[model samples]
Target: MLKMTKPREDETRTSAKKAGVITLTGQLAKALVQLAGLIAFSHLLTPRDVGLIGMVAVFLLLGELIRDFGLSQAAIQTAELSHGQASNLFWTNALVGLVMSASLFVAAPAVADLYNEPALSSIAPWIAVTFTINALQMQFQVRLARDFRFLTLTLTDVFSQLAGLVLGLIAALLGAAYWALVVQLLVASATLLVLRAGTARWVPGAPRREAGMSALYMFGLHSGLAQLVQYVASNADSFTIGIRWGAAPLGIYNRAFQIFSAPANQLLAPLTNVALPILSRQRHEGRDFYPLLLKAQIAISAALTFVFAVVGSLSEPLVRLALGSAWRESAPLLSILSIGGAAQALSFMAYWAFLASGNARQLFLHSLVTKPILAVAIVLGSVWGLTGVAWGFSLGLVVSWFISLGWLAKCDGMPARVFLSAGLYVLQSGLVTGAVLWLLNSKFGDHAPSVVILSIGFLAGGAIYATLLCLRKSNRTVFRSVLSPVAARVKPLLQRN
Candidate 1:
């Protein structure tokens, strides 16, 4: 077994706290940039144009996933990795990226043919370039995570997103249409690659057939398979919609899903980035990791529940305000999708647990079994159009959440009851808040402008949720635990000044 140096408990806790703060700030900034870009792009591009890009997104994302081949996860989960092994993995990733890029270029015509969109033929190849850029930076990103260099990671992420948003916006102004979205992705990937290479200390040497490399490769292979299944499962809705319902409706559905999932992707995504490395370290050190995981799930679930509740309650006004009246049809889709956002967010942490515990095979098996069910659900839901699809997708998410928790319990020896108990408070709080907001909206939502009504709903829902959380001792303890670190750092700075 490979052994590694472990940080002191206090230091680890402090680092984790700092990482959380930095990552959350970065994600918030990125979200703002993305939201602004989306608002601008929504006005600049037609629904068909946005939907065209969304159609290609599934393929590009799949290619990106294949490019990584789960090697990044392998690097992070492994306790010890020789420079030779790292170099080998780097080269392997680059090779996969190159091949996938070429494959995407070659497959572009087929994709366009499938969707009967001639423009996609041009769009697919441009998006393929991102795979190469992303592939080259994979190991560097993994190393940054391993070292907990979140500040650097944050800077890279924020700057790249800002750059991409600006470029995309400029392109849209110049009438690039769907190509503007393509430019945004390519620019982001290129910027991230350059920033990562400049900031990361490790440099790849020549690949060597080292002794430990085989295990890493095997781990990555399983992880890659699991990620592939998960990606397909997740994006199947878009794929089916794009093919069956066409671009305009797909665009509306995609945007609604994006709006519905913002809380999970915006908040929990950064948390997961911070959590996995720490959890992996904790597991390696034989530390008790369940409490940390529980706390994280509770906090994320509670926040997601609250946010999604508000969004779901005000789906119509939110959609109209965010995407304009042209996309008003997305309102019901947003509401339906938001129903499972909390469950999906909570289940995301299970991914960390699986990876940290070095259970990629189990992860693969779970995805293998569950993702097909999700795909089927999405297909069945597609029968009802976008709204039906949204409901179906949400149903799948709810089912997947329970299945994921059960798998985590079995694999990690975490009790199912504990997982359920941890999530119960957030679920209840969200339900109550949603009910209150729904009632408020029904009573007086039409009396005011959408902006005013949404503002009132948010404030009222927030107060109710806060009150409910404060009533729970456990929830208060979790809140204080998260806040205490920030307070500690801020107080020192104030005193020094």
Candidate 2:
């Protein structure tokens, strides 16, 4: 038997902090690249062109999620994985990827028919090719994550994003229209696969049946179902809008969502990658992880709330700034969607809890109940057009957040009082920030330059949030802990200067 040395508390903390910083830096770089691409693409492509891609994106995203089949999560969460088991999983994932790719190719015409867009028939199949590549790389990526090789993971992600953005821009310049977006997807997936294979030291051995394989498969089955339901609930609005309102409105709506969700996707998502593996290890060792989890939840909630507040306040200016005046209609949608963004940012922690605790069944059950409610909300909201759908989507998110809290309390033994109190504190902070930003926006009116208004609102809201954080002892400790490393690095630089 191989003996593994358990890292001391300080060592573990230091390693985690380093990994967090690397992941955050990478995500920030990727977000900047994507933001730059969005600005250029918005100008290069018409709303119809963007919308056409959005219409096909639902199918493509579903195919990718289905291809994953939760096996990646299974690999990450499992404490002890043998070479044989890993090899078996690799084969299973590749097979599923091949099937999904072929399935999407065959179903492309039907998807096009549903959207009443013949162009989608060609677009969907090309996008579908990414699945096999993604599948082949799944275990490699998971192993990097499992071993906390975040630097390698971050490098791969950043380079892939940059490469894809460049390719997509070139394709757009060449008048590929919607195909530009397809090129971006294909290039990004291919780049990631190539990089992961090159970087990961481990290669899968020949597949062989191993003991305890059934448990992994079972866990993956539930996890995959939960993922499928969650995706459907989240994307149903886009699906419905594309079918009813066509590509233009869907394009605008999709852009608004992407913009508003930048912080969650870029920042919080990466942190979750760091959090899950650590938490899983802690759980297996019977260590109490609630303190770390709680602090993280509070920090993420506070930060994202502040971000969304600024976004809500400057929605019009931001849309104009980011996408140009041609996409001014996305402004209101962005504002409405910001509400959901805040809700999601906070509630997303519950997912980490569910996965790290090895409670895939509980996660699936929660999704089974909540996803239908969300789907219904989207369907009903569709009757009133894009704005109504945005409203409904936000409402659904808020509801899901509360429901998830209840589940965490009951199923995971999280203290309801403690969790709810922390949530309310963050909610209060967000409201105060949002209100201050709103007042500033109202006072300035639309006459002010966007840059000036945005600068004022951001500074003012940030000051208010910082002041509020200092007023609470717990918040102060959390803030200080987060900032201490940065302060330490800056102090030496300042002294040298």
Candidate 3:
């Protein structure tokens, strides 16, 4: 048995913060790249062109889900992993990626036929290549993450993504249409595989059978299935919209989704990356994890609340400015999706808990129970078209959030009251900001430029949120807890300047 040495609590705490800062900075850079792409693509490509890539994205996402087959998660969270086990897992990931890539290549024509769009036949094959590229990246990334080498992880993410975006932007300029999007995804994957593998340094000796390999495989199986179910649930709306109403509506919804949810996901990702490995180490060391867990939850809810507040309340101006007036139709969808985003955000930390605790089977069971609610809601929502679907997605997820909290309480003995109070406090503050933005928008929205409208929303809504937090002592504590670390980090950069 190759038992990786556990980190001490104090050292782990310090490293976790450094990891968080590094990863967050990286995600911020990546978000900018995405924002730039969103702006550039909005101008360069037609809505149908964007939506066509989105249509193939379902398969691309499926390829991603299958590539590592949950082994990455299993590997990261394990208390101990043998070198032989690791090598075998790497080979297993490579084989799965190869199989999925070939399968997707064969399925391309059928995918095009399913969409009744001949263009997809070509697009899907290139996207199939990303599956294998990304699969090779998995074990390498897991190794870096296990060692808390987040600086390398972050650099690889940002630089490779920048390269992809540059190439994609060039392709679009040269009239590649939807192919530009495919090129971006492919280049990013290949770049990540190269850079991450180069930095991870460790090499697999051989894929020899080991005693503990079966348990790890089982863990991967369960974790991968759980993630697949959740992915399908979250994306049910896109599939339904694309199939029933075709690409136009799907295009609009996709834009809204990217704007509202993509940034939030990027923000949440660093937290998980930093928190899970630390928490797993804590579990292996038999230390208390709730303190760290609560801090992470507080940070997540506070950040998400502020973001969703601005996006939801100022949906019109945000969509207009980012996507131009052609996409103003997405504003309502963005607003509705904001509610669901918050609901999902609340449950997200619970996910880290499940993973850190190494409860893959339990997590899988929980997902089975909760994830279908969103899928069902999306289906029922299509009865009313896009608007109905948005509401269904939101309301269903809210239901799932409530159920998820209850489940976590049962499983982890989580302090539900504390979590709920913090979430509620954040939610109310968001509501206040929303109200402030609503009055601001109603007064000058029609006459004002989008930039002007957003500027006013930021100042007015930010002041209102700050005031609400200061009104109560408990809320003030929450504010300090979430912001002090951020302030501490920023102060040093200012000093250096």
Q: What are the per-residue Cα lDDT tens digits for candidate 3 across 1-497?
A: 54544433442223666677778888998999989999999989888888898898888888889887789888888878777888888888888999999998999999998888899898888889888888877888878777777788888999999999999999999999888998888888889889988888788768776888888889899999999998899889888988997777788989988987875678776567677778888888888787677777766776787788888889998898988988888999999888778877888877888888877888899989888988998999999988898998888878877776777788877777877777777778888888788788878999989999998798888888878767767667656865688899899999999
TM-score of each: 0.95, 0.96, 0.95
Q: Which stretches of candidate 2 lie over 4 Å from their true place?
A: 1-14
Scored by Cα lDDT, where does model 2 land? 0.85
Q: Each model's C-alpha lDDT? A: 0.85, 0.85, 0.83
| lDDT for predicted candidate 3 compared with the true structure | 0.83
Q: Summing lDDT over every window of 10 consecutive residues in candidate 2, give the lowest-scoring window.
A: 1-10
Q: List the residue pairs that clash in candidate 2.
A: none
Q: After best superposition, candidate 2 residue 65: deviation in angstroms?
A: 1.1
Per-structure clash totals for the candidates: 0, 0, 0
Which tens-of-lDDT digit does each residue in 375-438 have in candidate 2? 8898898888899899888889889888988998889897756767887788778778887787
Tens-digit lDDT track of model 1 for 370-487: 8888889988988888877888888888888788888988887876678787787787888899888888878877777889889999998999998987788888999999988779
How would the candidate models be sorted by TM-score, starting from the highest? 2, 1, 3
Task: Indicate the TM-score of model 2.
Answer: 0.96
Estimate the overall C-alpha local distance difference test score of candidate 1: 0.85
